[model samples]
Target: MAKKVSDIGGGRSQAVHRALKRAILDQALPPGSKLPEDSIGERLGVSRTLVREALVRLSQEGLVELRPNKGAVVSHPSLEEGRNLYLTRIALERLVVETLSGSLTQEQIDTLSTHIAAEEAARTEHAASIRLAGEFHTLLAQMTGNASLIRYVNELVARSSLILALYGRPHSSECAVSEHRELLDKLIAGKTDEAVALMTHHLDSITTRALLPRKDSLADALHAYAVAEGLA
Candidate 1:
């Protein structure tokens, strides 16, 4: 029988790691935010030791930086690092799509369509769109059926989304809805080469456009940037 994740100390470590990682990935703790170890430890109900270890794991993932005296700070990937992260994500996801092409079944396609539908609904409902778009990629990995690849893709997608949080443009929340559904349709229809090409194009669009300015709120914490861009 498989072990329940909540039954052991190791599981507690993983839970802390996951909780902290998600907070960082979602930018709930935004870039450059100092990780207050004691606060997190209190929240997670773990020792400072566990929280510190979790921070170290996050640092290894490039999501947090361990400063000599400043402790761990959520990473703010520079523009160059942002682009490189996106490029690497493109490469990895391209490979995943290529591998899944001509192999996915009708049921798999249907499942993905359902996930995409939820994403669209989330967009329509005005929920956090960037979070929804990231979920879309995560759903794709889940549907792809290769555990190892899914693990790597999850890491890449998470960190790539972090980069986007740092430097992505206004429409970053606006994922290509029609294109996503169409890619699944194409794959199910046995258009492997076309699916790969379309995957490449989709990633390119995200990477290229995120290089531009955003439609940030005038009242956003980044109001200075919004004003500088004449968006206010």
Candidate 2:
């Protein structure tokens, strides 16, 4: 059994959680990698109790898997799960665009434009580009001003990010950028039907890209992560 340390307390626990979550999202902890509480606790300078708490939070978010006797590992969504996740995301995003059409304030449009600029600036940086791509959808949901819908979209966006990390191949950022611009233009023009249709097509493109096979060995991924994190 992994030994649990109780001395570190709660404030540091949240930090542990954030660090672990960042690692997972950045694919520093790739799918199916074991998350030993002791190792993580030591790495982050937190207690095992803190690491376990962080793991629990991640599990609830569907980013970590908790096994009965084997401890925790990163969640690995199957091909079918990835398809279904994108399908659900498409439905929710369609709702987002439909609600925002003809109702977006000038300030909101400016904010979205700023976000797009940031995405463009990060286009050469793979992880940053992916994170910003997902944030674009979450920002749209936030504009709806519905807490419940925002929460749901946030979770789905995070899951979709993980799916892309696992299954997506390396490619130029131009396609996603162009698709987002088209969708934004439709929304700004108050073409609700066109915006909705474009949103559907954009999400379908993401799903199609995710379904393409990629050759990534576990050892290579882990080594890259270690070097990137200065753990090597």
Candidate 3:
């Protein structure tokens, strides 16, 4: 029972993080927008204390930058940062697949298959598809039954999603859902090496295609956003 209450703040923290992160990811907040504590407090109907705590946690996770006198701003990850993040993901997730191999259960395989199906159904639901695509790694880690690995992979996936949100060229392409389908085929066939190799290649493609910020500014971004939202 004590554990339940103790879990509440963590749950609230995740809620706030998801809300703010999605706003940033969807370009609602944009990359350089500042997150004012009191305003978010009022918008989300939470306490400033909770908002502050959440922002600090995001800062620690490399999703937000807490500056002196500047408060917290959504992190504008450079191309270097994007490459580093994906590289870390490749290393960690490769290990996850290796560990999960030969140990994966029929039940886990069924669960993953269902997730892939949902991904297909969500293709037209851009936000749903994006979230499900990010979940592919998280789902795999959880199926491996390693709590620590799941936690690490979840965080990496979250940051990676943020990066895509900030810099991804307008859904001109989609997450290679077919690659996930093939990955499942390998796992079911116990072709662990194939799955690992495919994941490496997949992430490498993302790194290669990413665009650095160049000289974009926050004011320009805000103006564009306001125009899109009919505020300008």
Candidate 4:
């Protein structure tokens, strides 16, 4: 169970949605874990209607799978599906870099640096570090000021988290953090070609990492996620 919707003061359904979505992204709700409507509704102190709606939204984002009469479960992206996702992300992120390299405002740069700092701080925490790593890309897309691009990047990043949960090596975040720093340096220098190249390399490395075998059990994964979230 996660925090209650009443704690956040938004519409019950939206709050429940965010809580559940965060749980999924953090791997507290691991890939392929059952998400029973009654259990979730009870946990969040929301109605089954709200829980169902929240799950429907997550399914649309590729974060959850809705099976026939099976209710819902967190998505378990296959290696092939992960590859396709990485391919799409690489193309979209190339466009993001191309648009932002020579045009980023100091404010945007500062915000990005701040995000990197947060990533650095979370380095010892696996789930937090990985989620921030994905968010770094979403933040970049947001800087482009394109609503459609932002939406697509957000969805892809969410799915990417699931991919990593299913296949990434435990030490994957170390390389990702270093590459993010390098990519930021290139962007700040306005090296469009270099930035794009680094972005491609960064994404390729992620895809490679996601193809590795994951050895952690679901209980172990949830424990790590809970510790990272200060719930342990």
Candidate 5:
């Protein structure tokens, strides 16, 4: 828990939000799991008000659903919903690659290469690799320098993580690293069509693995994330 309510009031709400978000993305808080305000507040040493605030923010980002009086739960996408999410992601990423093609600086290429190397190194750590894989797309969107695109990509990437956690089998992050490296090469080489095609194919492969089918203790779920966020 935080040392003071004032602390939570100031900026610790984002800490609470990050903890819950990380927990959800990593499947520590699986889809449809209850997120009671009091329990979260007590566990994180924040007030219910802060917890509610954090949850509201997550809800805005489509990671949490706020029921009228039942409080919040992780958003559980249906099979159809999940499919649509990935379809939309494919379109957005196509745009991302299009925007980035012929525009990638040597520095951006180096950054992406470094990120892929990190992904390769973290492949054995399932959760970290998954998070990094999703981040790779967001990094591309960030490079596009479109605020709206960045926001949408960030939200989609996060929800995609949640969806994969819910319905996906153990996938090969190694495959992702190789695909990302190839896609980057295409973009850096200014081959827009090939880059877009590869981007589509890469995202499609993940979608194929996901869109299939598919909980934990609330306090236990929140504990590790809260501690990581300096809330416990």
Candidate 6:
């Protein structure tokens, strides 16, 4: 048995929330998996109240569904929903590149470069690579400094991860890394049109891999994540 998570005395809810979110995003907690409050709390050594708080946050983020009598479960987005998400993401990311085109300071450019380097380093790690790929876009959104855009992009990127888990096939993180580098170059050159086009194409390629649609354990699954989060 995985040992119970400890060391989270007062911040247990946040820790639970992050661990659950990562599990869902990593597909360790697959779509439709039951998130029994007791099991999660017991596994993580948190209380039901903390578990509920985490679930409520995940629910609000569109990563978890709260069924009145059915408790909470990982969200299972339909094909149509997945398609819409990608379309919206494409549009939003276009805006991101467009907004960021000539505006990046040297320090910001270095930050992006460093992140892509990290992505390169994590190429062998499937879950980490995928999460980093999604986060790259959210990082861009944050740089845009548009509060509303940041919120929307963060939500969409997270849901997109869930969508990929449902419908995506085996992927190559190298390709995404290369594309990110090229996109970064375009942004550095202040080529608004070219940058937007590259951003659009990059996102479109990712969507194409998944938008087709096809296709869990609970405690045993959350155990690893609990340990990772130091909850176990």
Task: Give candidate 2 regions above 4 Å deviation.
Answer: 1-15, 213-232
Better of 1 and 3 by lDDT: 3
For model 6, residues 23-142, the per-residue Cα lDDT tens digits are 998889989999999899888877788899999988888999999998999999876787788889998889899999988999999999999999999888777788888888999999
lDDT, candidate 2, residue 169?
64
Best by lDDT: 4
Q: In lDDT terms, how accurate is model 5? A: 0.85
How does each model score on TM-score?
0.77, 0.78, 0.77, 0.84, 0.82, 0.81
Error of 1 at 230 (Å): 14
Worst 10 residues of 3 by lDDT: 1-10
Model 3 — TM-score against the truth? 0.77
Candidate 6's TM-score reads 0.81
lDDT of 5 at 71: 79
Question: What range of 10 consecutive residues in model 4 has the weakest lDDT sum?
Answer: 1-10
Estimate, for each residue in 118-171, the C-alpha lDDT of model 4 and write its tens digit: 999988887888789989999999999999999999999988887876777776
Quick one: how many clashes does candidate 1 have? 1
Q: All candidates' lDDT scores?
A: 0.74, 0.82, 0.76, 0.85, 0.85, 0.85
Q: Candidate 3 on 7-96: residue-level lDDT in tens?
A: 245777778777887776566776778999988877787777878988987877677889999799988877567778898899988988
lDDT of candidate model 2 versus the reference:
0.82
TM-score-better candidate, 2 vs 4: 4
- Model 1 regions lying over 4 Å from their true place: 1-7, 105-107, 124-127, 142-148, 213-232
- Point out where model 4 deviates above 4 Å: 1-11, 213-232
Alpha-carbon shift of residue 101 in model 3 (angstroms): 2.1
Backbone clash tally (model 2):
0
Candidate 2 local lDDT, 132-199, one digit each (tens): 88889999999999898898898888877887777776753558877887878888999999999899
Q: Could you tell me which residue pairs clash in candidate 4?
A: none
